[model samples]
Target: MIIEIIGIFFLLLLSAFFSSSETAITRISDVKIYQWGESKNRKYIKAKELMNSRERVIGILLLGNNIVNILASALATSILIGLFGDKGIIYATLIMTTLIFIFSEVLPKTYAIRESEKLILYASPFIKIFIFILSPINFLVQNLVSSILNITNKETKNNDWKQNLRGAILLANNKGDVRKPDRIMLESILDLHEVKVSEIMTHRKNIEGINISENIDLIIDLALKSRFTRLPLWKDNADNIIGTLHVKDLLRARNTNTNLLINDIMQKPQFISENTSLSEQLNNFKKDTVQMAFVIDEYGDLQGLISLEDILEEIVGEIFDEFDKQIAGPEILSDKSVVVDGAMTIRDLNRSMDWKLPDEEASTIAGLVIDIAQKLPSINETIKIDKFHFTVLERQRTRITKINIKLIVID
Candidate 1:
């Protein structure tokens, strides 16, 4: 009986180890492990290898876990049966259940959750050795699991590591491990490839450009007075972009070489399709030659301007400098009504105020209003869409320039 009891206790320790390691490994971050690998963080280097064969790692864990748990239960039952005869089955079951539940399952897993990174680092080398030794069994078990999934019409592969990463971030946020701004940035990074340049670009109407035909003094003044570091230079028409002039170059030309022509100082405009994804645009910007691109429609008509800063703003939210008075969002009045610039993107507004204004129909609040009304809204024209009310506070002949919006609860 004493020997059996000692064996049971030792098996319980093994069971606890397996249970905790299984939970920790599943929750560990592959990104963190690889980052540590880059710095030669020896403490977690083995975890990198374990993560390489995640499916196999899990198989070995379950195999070891089940073996230990069953041995412990069997040992407990035999010891109790020898002492209590026929009724020992119930007694053994209750005792083992309490002991296993408290010590082997919940308690260990709770510690694993709180210290997953540290635990995985320490345990990964041993886990890798176990996986290597039990490779044949792990392979067989994996094949059996796959066969069972197939038989039950279950999906074998999710393939969306991005969604899994997002879930991990969200889980961490809920646990207060990640702050809101950090969560936003992480989620935005995942959204970059899906978002298009047109959605975040400055509208052509709001773009400030100078005519290349303007006199040197006037051009220099415009460049200096302007808040933008880079300004588009056009020929006869605003749509006919000639090049982009940098304020630094203009100043350099003024001080050092006043003899330089506009053509000599300015860089050729980088034009991009309005439909180009932000990810592709960002890659384009990585080349040192281009800082901004003239966004054009399929017909080659100017639609807007997209800069590297614009793409970054999508990920990090609006970035402000001394020149940017209000980078994004609406002005909230004391009455709880918001006064918005018509050019404000629906996506930005939604994120700013936590509003559910749909961006699918139109990118901007003005475009949304026009789409909802089926006509160009006049000044002071009020339109109701869902629970929100939109009043066109100002308009030009061609576009809605400003709006006053309010949300009404219908109860």
Candidate 2:
């Protein structure tokens, strides 16, 4: 009878350890639960239920205390030889404690920590039973906790969804689920609204398009020799741009000789303001069935050209295709100042140079210089605005008028 009682005590202690181990392991966040109520997202629900019904859960835990109590009492009644059995009882107690420590406390908890998801799944039914069995205790606990909370003036705080979402993003980032460029691109896409069209458009001076009245042969000659597949066709100068013509359109034209006029092959160009957002313009492009748009100033002067590819480059960095012939990014000159390609987007320049160029109407460094100078900036000409100065470096029909920009130091 004595040996049997000591063994029962050991079993009860083991059960308690197993139960606690399972609960602790399952609560760790690294084990993701797919439902809305699982993980950090459902922390509030778990917190609320626990806080509100504290007494019930505590009572249930206390009920489990029978394991410890029955085990201790069994040792007292058995191995304990009535009055003089204190030493025997102590021996029995130590044996039971050691067994519980190894089997119930250490092993189960270790398994739980390592296999939390599996443990949680297995424990779910048991947890539900406990919740039901302890419902009355839960109600009492809830009222008591509410009353105490009222006294303390504590209100429940919900789960941090943004924090959780960030955690998920971080996890993906850590596991190589997304590459650095791809992540940056995703973020850049999200920041599209913060970007204006001027940052990504080709500057006006560098724009090469044939006039609508120009001979069809010249247009065809330029189109054929030219690297670009699409060319803006204007009525006069760029300011009067009528539409755009695709190389394919030229190929498909009924009359393909020098006598062919631009109006004969031109398709309408999408017109958008310099301040339009990239994401919005992308949608506009899709809706309008056009790949490119003419960016215009408030006065309707042609500022530059913006393409779907250009906007996409903002997010994904450089994209080189068969039609991509223009050099982009900045080239720091022999001097401290830089010589950026005219085709480089203002957004890229601003990010690279940390320049505070006004974002209102222009998209290229050249356009910004032109806007500020109000005329083509000449070599050795120094223009100062606030802390910055601009000196013209080089200029051409297709080249960026290289400029040396210096920031003045304030004493």
TM-score between candidate 1 and the true structure: 0.78
RMSD, each candidate, Å?
4.2, 9.8
lDDT of 1 by residue, 81-130 (tens): 88898788899899999999999999999999999988888988788777
RMSD of candidate 2 to the true fold? 9.8
Candidate 1 positional error at 10, Å: 3.0
The 0-to-1 C-alpha lDDT of every candidate, in the order given, reads 0.87, 0.67
Instruction: lDDT for model 2, please.
Output: 0.67
lDDT of model 2 at position 289: 86
Specify the poorest-scoring 10-residue window by lDDT in model 1: 36-45
Tell how far residue 276 is off in model 1, in angstroms. 2.1
Candidate 1 residues lying further than 4 Å off, grouped into runs, are 36-47, 79-85, 121-136, 150-190, 206-236, 245-266, 286-288, 312-328, 333-337, 377-398, 401-411
**Model 2 Cα shift for residue 372 (angstroms):** 14
